[model samples]
Target: MDWSQVNWQPQIGDPHFMGWVTVLVYLGCAILAFKLSLNATHCFKQHIQKQRTFWGVVAFITLLLAINKQLDLQSLLTEIARTLAKEQDWYDKRRKLQRIFVIAVAFTGSTTALLLALYYRKIIMINALALLGICFVIAFVVIRAASFHHMDHLLNQYIAGVRLNWAFELIGLALISANAIRRLNKNTRHRASVD
Candidate 1:
């Protein structure tokens, strides 16, 4: 059944809403992380001076990427549906875009990780979590695209792979959160001691 046929007034639960939920989750994580990271800008600037170019670029790009996702994902998703909603080759275009986005995210995320690992010294945990977050973001993008193409009532291998990858990424994010809290407490203790 075409989505148009669904009753709009009463609002039936479209399992397809899960795709939207996943996107929301990705955006939420980005926003929360971005805000927390932004709050540390002064510290990053002062402490990260030795690797200024790399760290500066990473911070800038991370902020830009998060803002872009907040603004761009919805419009892009609509554009995608309009262009490839009924096409048989929809998966091809999606695959191409997914690969491109994955590479971009991986590069940006890895660069951020490198900067923290090199400059911040104490954020080994944050860097590790950010890497995992990048992996999850890639999976999130791929899985959404897969759901879009799954309209043909067909089973695709990549969709399954993405779901499996997403599961592992959850574990990574949990570790990152734990480590971040630990690091925050440690920093707090050191600051108090100095005072």
Candidate 2:
């Protein structure tokens, strides 16, 4: 396979289109998170401190991820890898080892998060988010494995353009936004009834 013939640039489909869409979704979710934070502060005064902190973190993280996706951080990492490979003959081996390490860490972290979510199953949103996190981890693993094995065709086909992984990410962000809105509406109704 001619590596030079490969389209390294983002194209009109899977990944690029999906990536931009994901960015938009993340932005909306970030907005929802901020709104949730405000509602927590103004309406849910009983749990004001905890709710505000949680929603604030959600907003921050979602906004950061939106920026990261827009920037295409994975491509940047790939460029860094290519540059390091040019400098050192051992870079390829080191890169493979690094990939293995990342996979291990992702597996461990996702498992721990899932377990914690199970323990806090009363929080429906946490369970949903944890499941989404697991899906992201699985997608990451598939992409990494494809890259390591020189399965560029598979990566490009399933993971790159209108990428399944990016779709999962967008779905997760949308879920967060939807859940936040639902909770806010519920709280608002409760407060109105009490008043």
Q: Which number leads on TM-score?
A: 2
Candidate achieving the largest lDDT: 2
Residue 189, model 2: Cα distance from true site in angstroms = 1.5
Query: What global local distance difference test value does model 1 have?
Result: 0.46
C-alpha lDDT of all candidate models, in order: 0.46, 0.60
Error of 1 at 22 (Å): 8.0
Q: Write candidate 2's Cα lDDT for 104-185 as tens digits.
A: 7678767866674565344535326524543453455445432554444444456444655555555666567766777678
Give residue 87's error in model 2 in angstroms: 2.0
Worst 10 residues of 1 by lDDT: 6-15
TM-score of 1: 0.42
Give per-residue lDDT, candidate 2, residue 148. 52
